[model samples]
Target: MKKISEKIVRLRIVVIVLVFLITIGLGYFIPRLKVNPDVMSYLPKDDAVAMQFEDVGKRFGGNQTVIVGVKSDDIFTEKTLSLIRDITDSLRVTDGIRSVVSLTNIIDIREVDSVLTVSNLIDEYEIPSEPKDLDSIRQYTMSKDLYNGFIVSADSKMTMIAAKIEQEITETIDTNLTGKALMVYYADKYPGKMYEFEQDADTMKIKINKAAVADQIRDKLRTDFPDAELYFGGLSFMVQDIGDIIMHDIMLLGPIAFLFILMALYLGFRNFRGVFLPVLTVLIAIIWTLGLMAILGYEITLVSNVTPIILLAVGSAYTIHVVNRIGMEERNGGNYKENIVAALKYIIIPVFLAAVTTMIGFLSFIYGSYLTMIRDFGIFTAIGVVFSLILSLSFAPAVISYFPPKKRTKTEDKPEKGIIAAMLMFFYRLSVFRGKWVILAWIILAGVMTFGGFKLERRVDLLD
Candidate 1:
């Protein structure tokens, strides 16, 4: 051990350089990291929600939809009606929409020349170029019993131009659509292109929106037609907003947390090296782990985001404990070689136990029903735990030795007290109790907890 320290001291610069080179080399070979955007990926395949979503997606062809409602004070007025027509017309031409339903596309059964003629008011068979012709069509559109307020507002406050978006339509709307009514009109004309529709004389139903698709369309619409009152509803829209929120939080929270960790280290150790050295070690291990995941093609999901921070917090503890021991040893008159040995010997067993137990706590979660993300967390964190242990054992000792303090006369030992103290206090209190009484108390507590366990109720799925 003495010879090893002397040789390392002689090659201090080489060891430090090698550590940096190794970190950089490993990082380069590891691939860029990516995250799986779908939060559902972490859910178990056999889970009810997973099964339902899969079934709906396959059978009904995407239960997602994008609803566009146009509101005005008096939508039944000629001007507002014209606006509805214009909007519906624009939507009909929009790419990727499966179906569109508005007052414009509804059919009416009317007595024409004393005979009932069933035809769409806005039929492609006849093109009305003038207001008079449009008004004639409107008269028929209004008289029909089927043209209920479902397609229009009762008090004429608003009307809807809805689109059922296909999964492929998400790709198309992202690539091709333009105009405020692109979704509406697109669904109207190409209703059969990607998905089916349901009509209840007045109400229009189309396939749901896909998140990526809905968001692109929403952002473009919001930007280009800032004044347009757009009402977007559907599963796709919901997922799109969630994705945006995740990104926003990542941007806002990640850096602030890093700064907080740095501050914590600085407060604990009052020195530049004390604060940075340990942080650097954890960062290296995390980068290597994530890089390996990227190279191995594992997609990070929502749960994976928490692992890096957990690694940073827990991994730093081992380093700090070692550095604190080294600092204490230098203050108490011990040489670098002896202090390094003392710190490693003292911390190794305790830190190993802590790291192992913490890892077990994470690993136990693998027994959960839906554990894809948790599984990744367990594996990566276990790897980090190993790296932290290694660095604490080797690199930390080497670094501290390179900057060792002058030797002193006496080396005093610090006793481990917290847990031992609590145990002793508990034993002292229990000294008054008879052995039979203690056993009886334990039996009673166990019985009470067992009774409570049976009272636990299973949760219900509202959608189910």
Candidate 2:
């Protein structure tokens, strides 16, 4: 410990410069980090539910379906019917669309000369202008069990156009027993093997960017019908909305939290170095942690989204403790080297012990959690805590040694008598006068909260 303190004081400038350069290099990767809002993507690939989901997609084609709802006072009007037909035609010709189901595309079953025949309810370029034609079309649609409640609503005022997506397929042979069994099962179920997984020239092998596709559809609808009302619903839209909200909170709340911490530190220390050093330590830790995440091929998800805030809240405490100790030693008539060495010697073991315990607490999540998001959160937060401890012990003292605090006079060392002091005194008096009752009340409250927490239900609704 003494040798480390001597080395830090001797090589303070070199350490500061190295840390600055490394921080800048890591900051470059911050913009490259990707945000993934897909909750299912966070599940481990070997998880049963995730494997089943992939199997279903492979056997039945892409599971993603987009629903376009068209609203109007009456859907039977000639103009509304024409609009529907136009939208259906446009969607049918759009890329990435496997099939479109709507009134314009669905077939009508009929008996022609004692022979069953199927024909489109609305032929291409055939607009229903007459009331009789519209009525006939309505009667046919409402009577059919397939399209009655699936495509058209019960209110007769809203209709839906469902587009099934055929995602681009990537071929890979699986050697696992489960994969082999699934392949055999699927082959046996479909005798002719009509659904062969093949790469299509027009389809993407990777997951389709549903949000981008939804935006394109929305733009087209808005351009074609300026006054029409439309609502988009799908898994992709929900994921996109979640990503937007996460980004908004990070941008708005992150800086607000930093400002609040800054205010608190400045008011407490009344010294610029004391306020700046702790904030700088936490900032660098966050940058390094997030950069490491990007390099490890991890995307930011809902659970890991709060990592920066967590590091900021937890990492600053180590530096604050060390800085306060050094400040107190200098005020009591210690020289720069003596003050720093004494601070490091006294707090080094306790700080290391605290960091280790905190890291162990976070690492517990890795074993307790089934979700990949929570596991990644644990891993990254533990790394941040380590970085915080290292910076507090090495970089913090090195910087402080170079810019030693000025000796405080007797007047400056006096206790504060401000509103903060008054509040502290009041709390102290209460604790001394009513210590037993206060302890009893806290125990009861904690037990009630713990029991209530255990009864809480888990909800995974992304849209809400």
Candidate 3:
């Protein structure tokens, strides 16, 4: 409560700066970061739904697949047929594959000594070397036993390369390595579906890993064949791809927003101290939030990526409001103490309201069904918002008090009103011209809206 002065203000700023440095340093040094990605981990394991989901993922092949489409003008041509042979051969040796199906994968029909035998043919053939033999290959491909339309086109122009991935691999594969490798390469891909056996409760149906692995292989092939057309589908690959898109957007969008916020703060205050001080506060808050996550063992996910940028954008408003007030008071012949006090008095309610509203907006996410990353986001951002509110109130006051801008006097000639004043005048004129008409228009619009709402019927079964 002592008279606001330069020394008192500077002392306050020193305290804030010290706290920021300590928090940031502690954040960097703390160790612990856990990423529990399994959605089931958050749910009570004993719950029936959770158990059923786990069983489905395990017994039903875990939603992974690799699909290879072999396309050729003449799929039966010996060259393209041989290519299919080579690709199947490559897949069999690949690790973590549970099952593979193709034209060559089914039984091979052979006749010897007037008797016919149906045996696995994929193991019998070397890569067919002659283009002339494509006719015979086509005949063999069409035989009822080798491949139905499921693996080869009816006209023998295309064939499918399908594989089921092991569940254990889906559970434990290195995400960064596989995701990067697959997204970088791949041609037309389709994910396989899951079907359940009619009679067996424990038995599940379908393939896995084919799509994820195929995308990687396809991306690699792009280096040699730039025009390759690849399409990928399947529940597993779609999920992984969605996760990737989210990560990619965050990586690109967050920094750009932060830089824009810094620029806005500079333009609003027109002072180097005004820009740097709040920026430092924002940075410290960010590092502290993230550091706390790391210390508490949280992984950065799609939802948590925007927390820092949001803090920067929303938190800067406090500093901007305070400095604008200080600048206005200085121009009106007030001493530093009077200016700082007046600024604080004007902004305290607005700043507190903004912080509470922002915190509430984020808190709403805590009730969402997806809790793993989104919950973490809610908790972390809430902490940052609170810190932002406190710093905005404390740091701005201290900085203004310590610096104690040069005193103004009534005898001096006042500087001309600036662009802000001009803009306000223009807005005032616009209000005078349009105010009554705007109100009348809004009333009419509201009446229409109300009538429309009354006429509309609610449909509870719309989801069906």
Candidate 4:
């Protein structure tokens, strides 16, 4: 520890420069990280069944069925039946939809004399207009057992359109064209600046965004039938929903956590170095860990999206310990380099121990966990914690040395008498005055919570 501290102070310039360059390099990869909210993709890649499914995805694409439900007072009437037909036709032609099944196209079997015949439940083009014909068709349709409760509600007021998506997804081309000609036409139509395609004929496969495809399908449906009431469900829609949640989590949670951490740091240290330096270490650690994940082709998943917040909340502690120790040792008023070294020599073991214990707790999740999401959360969190510790020891001290810490004033030296202090006083009084009752309350609460924890239901779905 003494040797490492001496070296850190001796080569502080190199340490600072090297950390800055590496941080900048890692920061570049942060924007390239891709979010994959598909829960099935989290399946172990080494498993034979999963590999076979993935190969199918690469070749023929895959299925994620989304159901769109339409409601009406009378579904067999000409107007409602026509609307259903239009919806089926529109969705069938939509780019991302592999197939669509609805009341208009659902299979119907009927006995004609002695022979049985199979045909569409409702005739797409020949919807009945007359009341008698419509009622007759309705009676016949309602009598059949095949369509009940599955394609339509038992009461027949609601009908569901099931579109099995080609999960590879696609852009719905406006024209009936193929190959390079289609591309050329769009390029000419949109002109240079009007539109920009993220992928061409070749790159589309290499860079696929399933959530974008799902959203496109949703937008197309809503545009085609603006008046109709539609309810969306199933895996493809859930994927889109999860993708939205991940975006919010990444954009909002990190900043919120960092703000809270900053507030806490200010309360603790009452100095700029106390807040900024600790947070800086955490930010750098997060960037490096995320950059590593992106460069290695691991996705930002629903589970891993919380990585930034976790680092923000937990990783800053290492730097806080270092900063506090350095502040304490600096009171001796020795040489700057000597004081920094003395502080580091004593604090390194405690900081490393605290970090390693947390790392081990997270590392435990990598084993005996059934879900790959949990395993990934464990792996990256462990990595991030370690990175935080390294930066706290190396980058933090080097930067701290550059800015001489502010002298603690007599007022600042005294403990705060804010809400936290009042709360502490209350707790201290309770512990001293009502110690037995406090112990009894804790015991009862722990028992109840332990019982509740035993009854907790575990669910695997990533998106609600």
lDDT of each: 0.65, 0.80, 0.63, 0.82
**Can you write out model 2's per-residue Cα lDDT over 246-338, one digit (the tens) per residue?**
898788878988998898898778789889999999999999999888878788887788889888888998999999988877876758888
Q: For candidate 2, which ten residues in a row score worst on lDDT?
A: 190-199
List model 3 lDDT by residue over 335-445, tens digit each: 677767666766678778888998888877788534456776887898888877776667667755767665546544454377866887877887799899878988999
Question: lDDT tens digits, residues 1-464, model 4?
Answer: 89999899888899989988988998898888888887876788788888887777657545467788888986777888888899889888765566788888888888899999999877887887899988887777777776767777888788888877664433556445667876676567544321334445444322334465567768887998999878888876788798889999889987889889999999887788898999999998998999998888788888889988988988999999999999888876777778899999999999999999999999999898766988988999999999999999998889888887566578866877888789889999999999999999999999999999999897765443
Poorly placed runs, candidate 1 (over 4 Å): 1-22, 25-31, 41-52, 77-97, 106-161, 168-209, 406-464
Candidate 2 root-mean-square deviation in Å: 7.2
- Comparing 2 and 4 on lDDT, the stronger one: 4
| Cα lDDT tens digits for candidate 1, 1-464 | 44554555556567777777867876885555754444544567878887787677657645556666778875555555666666666555554555667766766566789999997666543455567766565565456546546666555576777766554322234333345465566567655433434443333354433555566556655665566566766555665665566666555666676788899888666677678778877787777677767777776555666667777888878888877877776665646667677666676677778878877777776676365777877777787777776676567777877676644433324432565557766786786666678888899999999999999998733222
Candidate 3, residue 81: CA error in Å?
3.6
Q: What's the CA error at residue 1 for candidate 3, in Å?
A: 9.7
Mind sharing the TM-score for model 4? 0.84
Q: What are the RMSD figures for all models against the true structure?
A: 10.4, 7.2, 9.6, 5.7
Stretches of candidate 3 above 4 Å error?
1-14, 26-51, 92-96, 106-124, 127-150, 153-158, 169-244, 329-342, 368-371, 399-402, 406-422, 432-436, 439-464
The lDDT of model 2 is: 0.80
C-alpha positional error of residue 260 in candidate 3 after TM-score superposition, expressed in Å: 3.7
Least lDDT summed over 10 consecutive residues: which range in candidate 3? 190-199
Error of 2 at 5 (Å): 2.7
Query: Clash totals for all models, in order?
Result: 14, 0, 23, 0
